[model samples]
Target: MTKIVPKILEDPFGNLTIENVLEDIVLGSSPYQVTNPHPYKPISMPRGCGFHGNQTKILIMMYSGPGNINQRRHVRQTWRELKDPNVRLVFLLGLLEDAQYVLEDESDQYGDIVQEDFCESHGNKSTKMVMGYNWAVTHCPAADVILILDETLHVVSDIVFEYIRDLVTESPTRLFRNDIRPDQHTGNSYVNLISFDVAKQFHILFPYIKPKDENLNDYVRTVANILSIKHIYDPYLDHENPASFFAFTGQNVSKHLLTYPLNINFRRLVGRKVLYNEDIPHQPINENLPPNIHRPTRCKLLRKGAVQDQFLVVVWSDAFDSEQRSTIREAWGYPNITVKIVFVVGFLDNHQNKIDAESTTYGDILQVSAKTNKFHDTLKTVATFTWIAQNCENTKFVLFLDGNINVNTSMTMTLMKELVKSNDRKVFLGQVNNELEPDRNAKSLTYVSENDYPFDRVPPRMLGLNYILSFDLIKTFDISFPFVKYCSAVDIYIGIVASKLMLTLRNDERFDRTSHSSFLRGIP
Candidate 1:
């Protein structure tokens, strides 16, 4: 093993001249090769380079953590068996002191390990992939395409091979060409494949010392734009919901695609679509907005002091009428020093341009990434909680108001202030309902299966129509969001969470369901 140097200025183990390091950086040389003893040595290789004679040979490399010994073993047992002349599996890891012994043992046994000298951290993952690319270019020069993937993925290489085969057959010109005009086909770097020529093109653009907080996908897109290589995005392989535990289940996968490690029983639980349902095509809902309109994210939307020095009021809104939003704004969105209003909305395809224009004008709409309008209601709860936790961390209390509801913002703030001063316990104030039964009807749209909600009796929860979440409660909810099973009913889900946490729900009559007569009709 060779000692890896972090910078050209200093070497930890051995002395290397700054001039030499500069030369390496200029010549597109890999610093990884310095410490690697067997740079091109493989624990396992295809007999006679398997498909070495083929014009478009491929090598699949996975970026793995030094500590994930078990994951490497799992890969060896599953997809590693699929390795052939055209396809090869290599685990790229950094030399960590804690796991060096295990990595060495595993390498000796499996012979598929590609260890580098760089220390691996969450921030340096991009560096590892870059080194992997450099290694592929230098050592595995025969390979035409390199598929970079995370070690956790369970892949079907046959499907990938078939897709690549067809792709190459269709666009043979893309194989040996470098002067093609670049296109804007950005893709997730987590699981993607790039041709050897394309990968080299990106390596040239990537600085030896990466920029601070640089995202891998952004870097890939930048390079992709320069190369004009159209992306071959396989939704079944790349589109994973990192937040959902059941996202990788078999049912979500297509028959003609490669999906992941889901069990038989869990996959059977997913609902199936009828193939020959009667054609009842409904007209697309038009937002009555202009055409070809797209909204670019503005810096002012994320500018500081937007939510500063005030109690953040996050109002949940679906594709409710614009009139409803205006009503709430006119009624409670007054010029107040203590309260700041921000609308949390899900993506509505028909109304996004309208929403974007509204956001640009007001700079108060906090748009979230929800796939469709149908996810508008359920996803808002999660997205709202997340935004508050991240952006409004220093703020006092957060008020979650519905789009259609009428609220006395002044009274709500007064009650919140009183509650905060009076009690030190986490404050969760709303119209508390106790022991509501879970919606168990299978045919119903709002059905709750035993898998989703196992409890017979629902926990006490505050109705989401109007509620105040204190700072502590927001923090807890943020941490719990990843673990909690999501349901469409926001109130019930929060109630179940409250029950789990054993937190007391404070009921306030002032947060009424019906608008008061004094403020009704028009609050003039």
Candidate 2:
């Protein structure tokens, strides 16, 4: 069972408290400083700053509407609590047409207040508010950080200020406001922060913001892509209660820092069993058999009386030491099975040594260029099989096996027998689990079903660790799928194509159910 652990941190804004009447009216909690001193102190600059020279200015743009006394009070109260030397708070009011009379008296009540006259129009207040802030930001060149706050938000000024400060300092680039809900197309409590350089780059890349009729989400997504900004969505901060703190900095930091929830209880329950220590013991082989044994005939053979020529085994070698290769060779070094190993080597300079070692072990090697191996494509590697199969016509059966897999001699024989026994002429074989247990924990073997299968399934699955294909099938595949220039994992590409072509896929219970190593049991 997977268990989730909660991370605990000191509440950054635990000190702010409001009267019951005020609390009942407000939707979100206010921000308060946890421990840090005021960030900046006042000067001729727009906002006061506590720390000179090094101080960062925070500009909060509060939007208000006429007759929104509660929202205005909330904004004023929030600003009062945020009265630090480094922060500046500005309130902007959007008045409906013919309601300009209401703002005349309130302008004197609030200092540093700006009003926009909207007459004979039913404009969206939210859009106007955003435009006002954009204007202020453009005009106020000195402002370093900007926080666009909705009037209804009750926040602890100190906590939010510090959280923003920490984010600006820690993030490789500025953080953007991102919506928490996946379904929401727009309007979530997320912000994007970019460095000055990135901001300039964005301006150059995307010159204009879309009009009101256009989708804002599309515009933002374009900007985000241009800037390569990472989005953080915090569900906890989108709430309207005291637990809202859990929604803010607390939730943000927790989600970002802890990719996986710590399973403390499960860790204690599993204990030292987490670290597995079993090593696979090497098995010796019997070299008494004929030098070139014919294909086994115990099972239903695809081509009746098909004379034995050469065994064609496909080796999916990643990397292996000489000893490991020798051990595998001895176990599988039968006269009937001629091994043709395919090496999928990536170009990353760091992995060059591993590639070199495998090349030394396997004589038949396919070198895939790393420049084209981007985005998990292995089709290019698999395409090389066409040339191998065409060149080696005497090869009867093609065996695909991962280089690192430990296959016993008996297991190989059993797999080969099953493949030969399969009745379908265009058959692809793999192992399947018997039980309905999670794929991660299932141990039993089962036969793969030949139901409605699609051919064009990329990286064909169920075909198990190794797939056996007859020479005829290979010839047909090469001819039918001429454009096999794959840039993805071969298994997936093969599966997808097989499914599209309605290929007959068979699962061998004996090979699928067998566990060669104990290490697989603990695989997460």
lDDT of 2 by residue, 414-449 (tens): 555555565434555555211211122124232121
Q: Model 1 lDDT vs. the true structure?
A: 0.55
Per-candidate local distance difference test: 0.55, 0.42
* TM-score, one value per model: 0.39, 0.35
Candidate 1 residue pairs that clash: 2-35, 43-111, 50-85, 182-228, 183-228
Error of 1 at 327 (Å): 2.6
**Which ranges in model 1 have alpha carbons more than 4 Å from their true place?**
1-310, 333-338, 373-376, 423-425, 441-447, 514-524
> What TM-score would candidate 2 get against the native?
0.35
* Per-residue lDDT of model 1, residues 421-520, tens digit only: 6544367877665434667898876566766555454555675467777766776665544444565566766764553333456666666555352111
Q: Which segments of model 2 are wrong by more than 4 Å?
A: 1-54, 118-126, 182-207, 212-218, 234-237, 240-524
